[model samples]
Target: MKTNESEYDRLLHDIYETIDNPCAWKDFCSHLRESVGAASVHLFGFDRQRDLFSWSDGFGLANAEPLERIRPLYRDDVRLSWLRAFPAGKWLHCGVELDCADDDDAGGTTGFALYPVADGHRCVALCKLVDHQRLTVILACSAQADDAPLAPAARALLERLTPHLSRAVRLYARRFALNADALAARKRAPAMLVSAQGEVLHSNEPAQQLLRATSLVRVRNRRLALTAPHHARLLEDIAVSEARLRSRANGAQAAAARFRALRIVGEKGEAARDASPDGASSASGQHEVLYAFYNVVVTPDDASAAELRAYAALTFYHPRSAPPVDEKVLAAAFDLSPAECRIALLLAEGLALKEIAAQVGVQHDTVRKQLQSIFQKTATRRQPELLRLLLNLPGGSAGAAPDAG
Candidate 1:
């Protein structure tokens, strides 16, 4: 009795400490398995709004059959009546056994019947709201039955663990909100955490606003879909190009070279930083708007056997509210020299020929010569036409980044 009591106490402490760190689902699930003596453990969450389901820390399920195959029957298990009506801090136990029964009249096996006691892979569970209080949690485990009732010990441990689990989720939400708020302070950009198939698991306010106002791209079933077929094709090509660039020999070295050559997609501002194999791909406004695609991996709690997990975190930057563009973008996009890029920006700012020369610290004739070169390179015949074109360039606002010349 003494040893059992002490072991249970220690397990409770470990579960608490484990979830205190960021992204602690795996560690918490491990501690849960050892504490309950269960064969498997799973943490699930249901988003009522999107009606989406996600699970993590599924122990002993790595080699198990894919959930999708079983999903038709068990995806939304009617047997989880208690789960649908779950309490905040209380642990729910569900176990039932289907056994062959003899037909009373025929004296032969008639049908299978569930035994009174709860029996299943998923034996214990907990739930809470996470991700800015928008997502719900259902943490559960599958512990095999012993002759003696283990419920008391399980309850004791969970009582100690539930509060911490809820707190950890709240902490993650807070961290996400803080990061997004910080970015919004500087720019009117927003981000999303999307599944590989494009399901949006989480989205910041800025992203929501951008989507509501924009028609070129829309969120359907919580996934990003492009309105223009051509735009979608272009984006697909960019993703393919970047992915191929990342797969070559000396891929790391080659990626840097290609990034410099393409002058597109990097963590300049609010880039997808999920750190998965799908890495973040982003595009800010050229003259329209910018979007970021972050790849996320969705590993189940019992990831011992399951596969196929990637997500696309979508981000949006409206051209009307975009941050200033760097000069490098101008030089690359318009194929202008450094001097020409600076002069182009100055011309957009309503500076006269002499004024631009003065600001650029060049002689009048030198500035005039540069202007002609800029005119030819930019395909504009005169200053006013050139100004209109430059002013309409992406991130052409007063708040744009310093002249990238």
Candidate 2:
């Protein structure tokens, strides 16, 4: 039951990778069951609005059965009573042996172990059960039986895995926040990603044009070559604000306040003459460095400046163009007619030929013929490679000559 370091690392790696994939939560549940030699594994996310629990993932449940069948046993059955006794918002480990009824359809009586993750506002729990004790030890949850406390070896394993588990949970939460922000940005403005140091890592078409037409220096491979002096002021302001927030006991409030102050400074400085000393004075003598901005402006349909400000505050800005492709440009680049260009754009966006045909009001064979023509002209053999080429094309015009200059 002693878990070696190499095996532990591999298991941890698998967990991290699974969580990164939005659709792999169910697989992670199965992997957890196998790694711990558990009969079954279940994951639940608390629903505060409905005041109920819902299954997030599972390993050994059938497709169509009501979860209530399994719920009643965990709620009232003597075997799982210990688990039900614990209050929410606390991590609990329970070990108990229960009798198995000979006629029971549920997985026969087996020892159980559970791990709960909670942060006051929400809770998630992972449950597992197995017939043997050695497998339980290898799984690394501390034992809570009154008759036998967790052994020294098992306790050591739990201690080692605790940090990793906590980090995994935090990473999941962070990903949720990022995805939410990205979706919001998609609705408002072109979003771009930048490194913490203000280097542009990605820009949408609109953002790229905006930066290049402005005073920013464009470098090879689509990177912006901004001098340290250019970004020094913003970096200094961020550093000072971060230092102040860190020194405060109420870090969260202080951090928010600092961010507001920085935003005001950014807005004021944004209007100043480009590369002027007045503009450079906004960051407390720190030079202007590259920064990410999510500019939410009102269109002709929306005229309220207040509404526009609200959108800007909530939306994240990046320097990227929307992912839409121009049909005329695509037709010229691939030497296709307008109809063929439309199909090619659909294919580039990962639609199957049948789906494209349905959307475009064409036969599937016609779509296939168009794809063949695209392949010949683009000299690409696979869908993935063609898609990549489309994405990397500058100005997003399919017909634009390749950047030879």
Candidate 1 lDDT by residue in tens digits, 1-405: 222667656645655564345345565566567776656666555444444443334556433422432332223344432233334555444432212143222223222111112433333333343432345655655544443333566656666667766776554433322232333333335566554344566776557666654455567876666545533543454444334433433443333233111112222343322334765433332233345443333333232323424334445555433333347657866788888888877776668989988888989899889889988887889988877676455432323332212
Q: Model 1, clash count? A: 18
Q: What is candidate 2's CA lDDT for residue 67? A: 45
**TM-score, prediction 1:** 0.34
How would you encode candidate 2's per-residue C-alpha lDDT over 282-372 as one tens digit per residue? 3443333334443221122222332221111211222222345556556656687777677777876778889999999989898888788
Using all chains and alpha carbons, the TM-scores for the candidates as numbered come to 0.34, 0.27
Q: State in Å the error of residue 256, model 2.
A: 52
Report the backbone clash tally of model 2: 17
Top lDDT hit: 1
lDDT against true structure, model 2: 0.43
Give candidate 2 regions above 4 Å deviation: 24-27, 52-55, 64-66, 69-160, 174-405
RMSD of each: 18.4, 18.5
